[model samples]
Target: MATNRSEKTVSVLKIAAFAALTPMLLAGCTSIKDRRGYVMDQALTTAITPGLDNRQSVEGTLGQPSFASQFGDPVYYYVSSTTEQRVFGQPEIEGHEVLKVAFDAAGNVSSVTTAGMDDVRDINPDGDKTPTLGRDRGFLEDLFGNIGAVGAGGMGGGVGGGTNGS
Candidate 1:
């Protein structure tokens, strides 16, 4: 009985140790701050004015930009992304904030503008809401259309329907 008790105690201790250390181990792996350094570097590179120095240079230090325009005046964008992840799962974006800064000919800050969650547009903005081009058919119409020849099965006829008109 005493041996069994000692074994149980040891098992409990191991489980407790794992429970405590699991978060630390996982936190080290999933911490977003580690990944955020690169974004900060990019922002600094694009945002820094050529002639300006110190606070004046960083007056409009934006967080993160979603995109930078490739054409015309070089546009710097700052975007802030919040993501959530579960253990052994993929990370999901929770929120985003964006700022657009345009630099003029001299490379000094020209204009600073900020946009938030509402400013972003969906990739498929009119996905479900947009009306279909053709006459909207009922579910049964679509189902039957899929099963028969005139329903786009082609002139080859259909399964068990025979190739030639007998």
Candidate 2:
């Protein structure tokens, strides 16, 4: 009887342990298809050829773009990302791809090209310089700053105290 009870306890413990770990294990196994559609929409692949598509005919089809630039000449960009996650392991980037399409003055595809991670460059690689609007104020200038003392008697406590007796 004692042995049987011990075995049952062990079985229950195993079940509980598996139940606790199942979610985390499943989380790591999520496939890219689950996130691909949403990511693609957020990246805005369609807007890449906005003005270029004419009313009469289609000049060319440049599949998708990674994202559209907030500033600069109108350009559409497309990007693909792959990530791997494992139990007790940090998610790591497995792969990435980007494509860019630029339109010409007449609103037709001007150029199409691919850009890898290495090709991208930070506009302000170093850092922004702090602006020097003017010279720093001295200690005295800060202490005797803008505020002036209360006028002679504007309030009850001032020199022009109202008729109310103290």
Candidate 3:
């Protein structure tokens, strides 16, 4: 009887242990991770040697950049990021990289730059309202500000005849 009771207690403990750990175990299964944006491989990135690799060579080697600049030498950007989300919460950036390549007028690679999370800057906005060079007024004030500004006077004087009939 004693041995049987001890076995039963052990079984109960095992059940409790597993029950306590079940949530965490199941949570692990729900963790989602995604590798997004420009896929940067070491060998592929190293293959691009500035001054040697032109637009054609670079594109042929690593494909199109994530984006390109609008002006100047037309900088090309390769961005990569890894996001991790648990359950239904917002995804968090686990890794980030910004690779930039500047091309000269001849389309030859002029410079290569790389940035990571370490280079990220935190921006703390001052307030909700955006500051602009204009007078700030309430909604009602704006709605009524131009109400009486324009005169209701119909067209300049007369359009041919008023009292002269000519």
Best by TM-score: 3
lDDT of 2 by residue, 2-106 (tens): 999999999999999999999988887765422231133323344444455631222234343446667766566666666766655676656555666666656
Full-model lDDT, candidate 2: 0.58
lDDT scores for all predictions? 0.63, 0.58, 0.88
Give per-residue lDDT, candidate 2, residue 138: 74
- What TM-score should be assigned to candidate 3? 0.62
> Taking the tens digit of each residue's C-alpha lDDT, what string does model 1 give over 14-133?
999999999998787763421221143455555565445332354446434456689998677766767777666677666665556777766666666666568767774555666789
How many Å off is the CA of 23 in candidate 3? 6.6
Runs of candidate 3 exceeding 4 Å displacement: 1-29, 142-151, 154-166
Worst 10 residues of 1 by lDDT: 31-40
Q: After superposition, how far is residue 144 of candidate 1 from its true place, in Å?
A: 2.2
What's the true lDDT of residue 115 in model 3?
A: 97
Q: What are the TM-scores, per candidate, against the unseen true structure? A: 0.38, 0.39, 0.62
Rank order (by TM-score, best first):
3, 2, 1
Clashes by residue pair, model 2? 65-77, 65-78, 66-77, 66-78, 66-79, 67-77
What order do you get sorting by lDDT, best first? 3, 1, 2
TM-score of 1: 0.38
TM-score of 2: 0.39
